[model samples]
Target: MRTKNFVLILLSSLSVLTFLDRNAISIAGHRITEELHLSESQFGWILTAFTLSYGLLEIPMGLWGDRSGEKRIITRIVATWSLLTALTGLATGFVSLFATRFIFGAGEAGAYPNTAIAIRKWFPLQERAKAQAFVWMASRLGGALAPLLIVPLQMQFGWRVTFFVLGGVGLAWVLVWHRLYPSESPLQDNTDQQQYVAPENDAPRWTVHLKDRNFWFLLVMYYCYACGVFFFISWLPKYLQAGRMIAEKDLSYSAALPFLLAAGGCLLGGWLSDHLVSRIGLNWGRKLVPVVGLSLSALLMLGCVAVDSNVAAVIMLALGLATMDVTAPVSWAIAIELAGKASGAVTGAMNTAGLLGGTIASLGVGYLISWTGSYDVPLIILAIQLLIGAFFASQLKVSTPRALDKT
Candidate 1:
């Protein structure tokens, strides 16, 4: 097998473990809340703790990957987060859980940004979006699997044991990755890989992106989009149970449906974007998916809120996430296109914005639920954010990264 394909498989596997570990808390949220005797507002703070630290550290970790190399940095990231994931099972109160999740966020920071750097290194420009799709698809698969796997395990062995099992799974991946990742550059066909060197005097500074209007637009768009995404990640299970009156036994299937469809969305979006790019051009090809997808997703989210039947609400919510995710890979591809050699730092900045959005969603949803006495209010707010994101997506003006222009 080709080395790049092998590396992609490894990275995709890591993406699976990343979301599985990340989503476990949300899956086990009810039990955790009950056992800890935490209020909804406190629960929101716990979730926010992760996003806050994750956002704060994203750029630094991404810059670390760009300056050094992804292999070592990603290894450190997985190990630290895996250890923290296990330690989360030990928390006795709200403060302990909050601290563990915050530190876990720091450990998990830059994972995707580093993955973006690796994709830029190993895949040709045309293949990058598909590669990103596979990775993201795996993440959705992980999210889907969380309730399926965690519910049963936590029921049998307890939620804490479920986390221990997840932590062990991640550590095993770390060992496999260390052994399998290519020791040298894998692809010679990609000009970007061969031509871009980090130390060149004209190599674009990370700060240079600050001057680009497109960068700000990308950041804002992702910021708004992430609120929708993180709502699924951090709040969906609780919402399904408490807000929608989904029975506990049925939680796994109901919660898994959106992510299952979202996995497909990633694949469809990647293929559609690549095909569009071939038919037209990069600017429109990339822009079209997010604009159309997010608009539709927003409407569907409102439908989820408006529906009276539980089954109809579930379908609408599932479709909403699926449509929103259709833009995920193409958005990452745009970041890669914009940054080239600085892909790590640029994607990091974009994701920092995303995590900040997630931070707000995680905390705000809890408050909204408490204040409004319904989950509908938070969903409405998120849908509005998606509409704004679609507007920003439409406004993005694509240009070659300064680093690539120099080359």
Candidate 2:
């Protein structure tokens, strides 16, 4: 493989690893609840712990990536997070588990921004969206692979072993990454061919980026979208089992179907965005990909809420998630574009905002379902949020092209 593409694949594998670690808890949720003697609230907290820290640390980690080499930043990320994942296996109670998950989130927080930075360094502008999409799709594939592989592993060896096994994979990835990756430059010949790697400009500090209305718009957009997507990830299997009357054994197959579809959607999203940009222009392409995806998914989500049968509901969900994926790459690519060289800080902040919404959805949606006696209410609420998110996404200006400018 070419050095550029090889790096992309390695980075994509890191995307896979992060999701594998993130979703491992969901796969083990049932057993963990039983063993901990926990309520639904506590189960929600288990998920929340990871997201809260992960979201909170996103900007800092991202800034770290932009300033430092992605090689060292990613190495640190994989090592620390892999250790946290292993520690999660050994947790004795709620506090221990929550702490480990939070630390795990902190450790893993830098992965995406670092991946974004790496793509910026390696890929030409023409392929960036497709590149982002491949990484996102790989992550989804990891999510899809989790239930299929981890659940069965949990059955055979126990949940703890499942976690340890996954952690081992991350550790192995770190060693391979450290050995194989070259120190690639972030810029090429920009002005009159005078070029070498320069230090990242300090202009995109948190305070400055946070103050921008456009930044906040993207933040809100991601948050609303994350809420619904996470609601499904955290609760979908239970919904399938409880509301849809899908059998316990069948839940695995049914639950995985949407994620598999989600992987396909992610691939389609990146390709479509690139195509749209090439055919029309960047601004319209970026805006329409997400706007269309979210709007289409919103309608599907409303239908999902109203549908009665398991078969039909699952179909609607599959379509909804696939449509949602279409905008996934744009959400990421634009963050870096807008932030310029400080893509790390902006991307992290943007992701952190989304995770805040997701964390709330994970906990609140659970309680809402408990009180309301159905997943329908929370989903209707989420569908509305998706539309709001779509509105925000539609307002983006790809013509700005801040990424191309000197800071």
Q: Local distance difference test, per candidate?
A: 0.90, 0.81
In terms of lDDT, the best-performing candidate is 1
How does residue 108 of candidate 2 score in lDDT? 87
Give per-residue CA lDDT, model 2, range 1-407, as digits (tens). 28878887998888888878887887677778788887777878888888899888888889888788789999999999999998899988899998999899888887898888887776656677898999988888887777788777887888899889888999999999999998854353243333423223333444566556777889899998898788766777667766677765665667777778988888898888889888998778777888989999999999987877788899999889888877778888777667656777788888888899989998887788778887789889999999999999987666433333334
**279-325 in candidate 1: lDDT tens per residue?**
88888988899999999999999998888999999999999999999
- TM-score, candidate 2, is 0.92
- State in Å the error of residue 388, model 2: 0.5
TM-score against native, each model: 0.96, 0.92
> What lDDT score is found at residue 395 in candidate 1?
98
User: How many residue pairs clash in model 1?
Assistant: 0
Clashes of each: 0, 0
Clash pairs, model 1 backbone: none
